[model samples]
Target: MKISLKKTDLFVGIYLLSAVMFFIISIPSWLLDFLLAFNLSVALIVLFNALFAKEVLDMASYPTILLFTTIFRIGLNVSSTKLILRDGDAGKVVLTFGQFVGGGNLVIGIIIFIIIIIIQFIVINKGSERVAEVTARFTLDAMAGKQMAIDSDLNTGAITDKEAAEKRKKLQQENAFFGSMDGATKYVKGDATAGLIITGINLVGGIVMGMLYSGLTVNEALNKYTILTIGDGLSSQIPSLLISLATGILVTKASSDGELGDEIVGQLFSIDKVLMMVGAALVVMGLFTPLPNYIYIPLGIALIVVGRRLKKRTGVEAIEEEVEESEAEAQEIRKPENVVNLLNVDPIELEFGYGIIPLADVNQGGDLLDRVVMIRRQVALELGAVVPIIRLRDNIQLNPNQYIIKIKGIQVSDGEILFDHYMAMNPGYVEEEITGIPTFEPSFHLPAIWITESQRERAESLGYTVVDPPSIIATHLTEIIRQHISELLTRQDVSNLINNIKDNNQALIDELVPKLLGIGEIQKVLQNLLSEGISIRDLVTIFETLADHASVTRDTDILTEYVRQSLKRAISGKYFPSNETTSVVTLDPNIEQEIMSSVKNTEQGSYLSLDPERTKKIMASTGSELKKLEDMGKNPIVITSPIVRLYFKKLAVDYYKDIIVISYNEVESNVELQSVGMVTA
Candidate 1:
């Protein structure tokens, strides 16, 4: 179970509520007074500590602060009592000070709260050095999921698996070493500023609590300590100064973050030694017959300076150690070349297609504007033609007179041939010419003449086999027409063409493949096309239509049946049928018998045939849809029967042509046009 921030906040709320209710309700009246004062001062401090400690020492920070505060407060209480019991003069001064500062107990409790707050702040406010480490860790954790997501998407056919895997692998490998570097960097940028701010806030709160408690109680307890002098007030605050100085130094030392077991100069000096020095000095001053009130100021300032210097020195050394460690770890991650290679290349494939186009110099109104330019340089080796594929820039429109032609993708020589030479021979179209010259029987023709030889030769070699009348102007027109159609039959165009074909002759789809492959140069271009994400089946459909236009096929019953079956598969969205069974439920004998009984009961020796039942269903769906158009004041033909679907498919080509024109006009005018208007137009 992943822990969320919301959960953490909820836990904190629960902890706070439990603490407030239990501690406040259970204590005796007198004890409760003391506990209330203590809890009030410490509540915010403890909460801050809880929040900060999570970052400081993996849960240890919180418990450590709690333990230290308890011990220190108790020790302060003991010392205050000893002074009051042993020396009348000191006792008088101490009592007066304690009462004025909200009593000895309140003062001590407040100080402890301040100390914990400061410690937590220091821990939480760690600097930028750690940010990189955190980012790196986050990156590493995210990589595996990202890679898996890519794999799942690809395997499920949402995208190509190879592409997804490769992209993810690249990112993961690049950032593998980043995490280590980040960890070391963050360790050196300890929480000094954060610790200081926390300490400052706690110090202010402690001061306010101490002042309120002491000021209020001091007058009441004043007569108890007759020996109390003006100087006692100043002298009494020495411990607070000493504690703050000691804490600041301690926080700085903690920030150093050296080796877990490394011996430091501060470690040698020891917390015990530091405490003993302060304790002995205080005791000696107290034992004196006449203690100077200003004695603590110098001592407090000295201790602060000493602590600050110590922290500064140790911190620098710790940072150096961290930097060296990072460099060393980075070195270890450098595996032998082969091991590195394993994680280097992603499992993704980026099929190289046409090169980038130069659009800056293109003129929107020029003849070249409507022409598609394909960069054949990369896949040029597979095609016989110079241009491998076509891509038209913006500001170009398809010619209304042009019809798209596509050749089935077949591997061909030089990657430029219109169709595969080997497949072209399959339909008995290849033969010796009548003029005793070895030439293609279906010679390339065009409706225009005076066009450059480059265009004519390109069209012929690519299998355009332009067949134009002998008139020069006719040849030029034919060439121009073929070129315009070629430009329009780009990858996008071919896809739309296949969709239209599939809508009509789905049964003959398999046979359509060979015929489409018979179109010139399309087969040669298929390899380059795979990268563009054109499906093999759709590509075959486009080629088939082009082949059909070039060589009209006679209507045959066998071909018609094939077309129908293909259409059914398409309508049902069954692209690839498989023999493998994926469902795991086993058939029960009793259920099987029951199913057979049901079937036998329903069986009336009636065979399923094309009839009114099926036709009625189609009509209900289609006619209802057509009625919707009519309600909207649109004139749409209602063709429900399969026979009518066939007739419309052949004859309704002009209907779609008109629809496209109306759509174009609406777009040009930037006005919303109703489908009814479009249909009527």
Candidate 2:
């Protein structure tokens, strides 16, 4: 049988093997030298990797690497201590370090080793551990908000599903990596403590062994054993210091597009004025103080030269590069495929002319974008549907004060507003007229005037409803969206809605979706409800109703009527108070009979086929009654028999768009109804 191991497996095997070898009684001097060298090389590699990594996830395994290297260093400390206790010399590496680096002074070597430990354990390691903890906490706290943003982007078509998934995965990995680092920092702290304890043991144990067992004198034993113990401590502590520094760099470094070294250099020297000021200050100090001219003058002059060169390069070269990049982007935009991308349309778009730009700019105190996001949230709560992002842009072809609202590339409404003026509407009881440019409110087409800022208080004193430019636009956009919501509900949106509730209602969804009724069929039912201004927020009830009657009727209009009857309370509460009587217009019995008689049923659906003359009479009567109800300050609702409700709605929709048509079945038992007017034919 052949045995094959992957790279990761082989690396793990080598690590375990090395861990076991640290327990051996004796290690050769040459092997001890090799281990010390390997420790230093690993520390250097870790530092470079941390400094150059483009993203945190790119160094996902850094915590593991840190743990393994720390263990290896501690093992080396143990093995070298054993060697020193057995003999005066630990190895060539330790001996050279003690004699050359410390000048063969035991006190100097011991002091140097103590300083290294203090810096690593008290300063670098402590700070890195704190940073790791804070970073991990912040990453976890922001994870939910970031995930929601990704979902919003995907729903708005700003990003694809795959891209959203990748971003979510990267975010999760980053959280995990930082969390691991939080725990791994403790390893470094412990390793430092262990090193200190081991060095103390080596010094005491080496002294006792030399005097009592080898028969050396007190002074002689002190000199020989102390030197060897200091050497062993310095050899292990130096690499420990390097590894600790690397951990500090990894945790404290900010994210950047380039390497850490390049970022440090570029940012530090980017401002030429600062460098010039520093150079001038240095030159002044050199002249006023006893500093050598040979050292300070040349350094100052070199700084001044470099500052001038950087200033010229950044100013001229940066502009040229920007111009080139813009030209390249323009060329790419002119390509056929890029132009074709413009053919894709937003579900809702708001376009304005150049004069209204300040209304959308946040720096100018405009809150249009903020208002738009709030509008989306409000609509979702009210309508029980996710509103796609509305794309806003400027169109130079339009008049400076003109704005247009579009749905799916077709303009639905257009108006002009004075950006610098306020709209003051006479609330049907204003005692005085305000002197200004005469206009009408864009949303409701109510008569209004655009008054100056000085007239705002005067208009309000006269009971006029005054609004700013943003409020006017926001109100108009809201009304437009409310009117066209039916067109916005797609199969994908229905799927999202179902998926959102799947965790709690999995069985209901499994029974109703793609089995009893397809998603497209369900979408049509929802659109029907939305078209009639009925909120489907109670989706559980809606799905249950469909599951009960979907097999009986395949017609969406009929199914929508069933859903409406099931949501009677929600519908009633929308137009009237729960305890108040619902005031509505009642169709004459003769007209109801005529409409019910003209209803034709086919494989397609049920519809009315009344004669032209009769249709005109019915529309004329309904319009007159609806106007009366509107004048009385009562919202107009038409009530008829359940069998003729759908047919009557079809007849009046084109002419009486504002009137809500409901059947007797849609009225709940808890509410009372009063006939405010009669639509007679």
Tens digits of per-residue lDDT for model 1, 182-227: 4433322222233333334333433344346445245333433322
Q: How does candidate 1 score on lDDT?
A: 0.35
State the lDDT at 539 in candidate 2: 95
Candidate 1: regions farther than 4 A off: 1-17, 22-350, 353-641, 644-681
What is the C-alpha lDDT profile of model 2 across 187-233, one tens digit per residue?
Answer: 99998999899988988898899998889988888888878777787
Candidate 2: what lDDT?
Answer: 0.86
Q: What's model 1's TM-score?
A: 0.21
**Best-fitting candidate, measured by lDDT?**
2
- Each model's total of backbone clashes: 64, 0
The ten-residue window of minimal lDDT in model 2 covers 148-157
Instruction: Please list the C-alpha lDDT of all candidates, in the order they appear.
Output: 0.35, 0.86
Q: List the residue pairs that clash in candidate 2.
A: none
* Residue 635's lDDT in candidate 2: 85
